[model samples]
Target: MTAADAASLVPAAAAGRPGTEFRHGLVVGKFYPPHAGHHALIAAAAARCAVVTVVVAPARRESIPLELRLDWLREAHGVTPWVRFVGVYDDHPVDYDDPAVWDLHCAVFRAALGGARVDAVFSSEAYGDELARRFDAVAVCVDPERRTVPVSGTAVRADPAGHWTHLHAAVRAWFVRRVVVVGAESTGTTTMAAALAARLGTVWVPEYGRELTARKLARLRLDRPDATVFDVTWDRDDFVEVVREQQAAEDRAARSSGPLLVCDTDARATAVWEERYLGSASAEVRAAARRPALYLLTDHVGVPFDDDGLRDGRHLRAWMTVRFRAELAGSGVPVVELTGPHERRLAEAVAACEDLLAVGWGLADPLLPVEG
Candidate 1:
């Protein structure tokens, strides 16, 4: 086959058996990276199965590392809400370069699902056929039309240049639900976020960053721009006052239900804006900026300026990206940058936020380290 043909080959979800009544089904995959094809296969498998249990390869010794591959499977399946990530481990290290252990990989799968009344097995791999035989259940291969769909992770990593975008989306939602929309003069970050929260049935956090920035501006006597005062002691009094009301709202939202939280600007963004406009940074102000899931950096789009002093044109997007990354790096929180026209950028942000949320929430509480 030509290189293009080779590269075009993508893992397709195997067609699952049709259902009239509920059957106990288990879907297993290395899920190197969950993609749309896997999604199709999963939906089919779950429909026939009353309770769908997703079995993922826990050992990432092959490629893509261990943790990330597991996360991909979790997020990909988490998007469904009904699906879940259960462990299937190969705890004993095997020489990946040796072919002897490839067939012995089912011990973890066996242990994880031991004693369960599994009616059938679902997978897109030929090895899945062997797994079905071993488990004494019908092997439901995902290749539809009785066509041989040849695709595997080896093919993907074969070329270091291969794109994994298709694979990443397949199971991204399980980890965190990301909403990275912008707050402009009018498109309503608040209103759009509220609407999205209502639609997705999640909680909404307004751009608390805006209120924080406004509060910081009020505290700084910009006329003395040359002053050397640069710690939270001098700059944080205004921030404390601003956050008093803001914290109450966050406290309420934190206590409320919903897997996703719609945050208005975070305290981190507020700190960056203060430092930029005032030419200084303090320890206390820096602490608050690290709190938001991400920053939207509202541009002069959507709604026109109605005399709000917060409007900063020209360098808004570029500067926000820099300032946000700089502030967030200390906390090791990754930020996704969303940019475009008024409504488009806002929507992009929301989508990104939902993706992160999918990844974040997918982890079992015990596995997830609590964030301060």
Candidate 2:
């Protein structure tokens, strides 16, 4: 790896010309959960080469899916058109000194590239020289000392909360702790969700079912001119739409939330609402339900039901609370029932969220070299 072989860093906007030193560049990594450091290396490669090919090779035993890693890399580098990303499963044991192990790993990389010529190999590892020699290419090492980004896959896997700022929005969504507040109508669900989000300095997802109910009532009044909330009718399709929109909103919010995300309601709660109006929960609604990290069920025991105009379940609040408790119990997810004044309920909700965060993301260790 001579000085001439190492390409100087350049801006991403000024890269991707055919007359550069290398025509084709290659980068390979596990990218278990791509952090800022990984992005910087890929950007550096894209800066000097006309076309860069990134190979994401993770072991089959790894926790994160190969397709998801590819998706994250592609999305992060979508601005650079010259960069291409591919993925392949590599379960070979890690051994830098053995030639047979090298051959096994390079074979997987070549298969992913489909015989494309690699004139330059960009990496931050000590094995860059050997990898470049195998491909008969120059080694362009960037940030070999981890001084720029100051983060690694191992550090992130062990403690995501400590390195939260180094992770991309998409990757953060994978580790975000979701706490959903669910209960009967007007049972302080919205208020508690907003309060929790504010307390944690994060974002909260509003219930889509409430929005849809208001929309339905407004549409009915346009025809009858005096229609009330009771005039609004709900069908199987309405509940399905509610579940779809609710999950979409939750996913969008998760990307921008802090380590913890607060939700007014979730798809599982939509199933309960479906049963309330439609006589039974549909298979579509049930199938769309996903388990969150924790559920804070606001009991209707002490909370007063406030109907602003879109709610018609004042008398059914007690029944809805019972149904919600039963549903959450059957799902096998952790749930905490909140029963008391607003202050007490919020305190209990916060404590439950803290406990959920304490239990870190239990990601399995990646394949590594053994000490002699």
Instruction: Please give each candidate's TM-score.
Output: 0.44, 0.92
Among residues 3 or more apart in sequence or in different chains, the pairs in candidate 2 whose N, CA or C atoms overlap within 3 Å are none
lDDT of 1 by residue, 43-77 (tens): 77766655556666545344334456556656556
Q: What is the lDDT of every predicted structure here? A: 0.51, 0.87
lDDT per residue for candidate 2 within 57-161, as digits (tens), equals: 899888999989888888899998777777778999999989999999999887777776788999999998899999999999999899999999999999898
Q: Which stretches of candidate 2 lie over 4 Å from their true place?
A: 1-16
TM-score of 2: 0.92
Question: Among these predicted structures, which one has the highest TM-score?
Answer: 2
- Report residue 295 deviation for candidate 2 (angstroms): 1.0
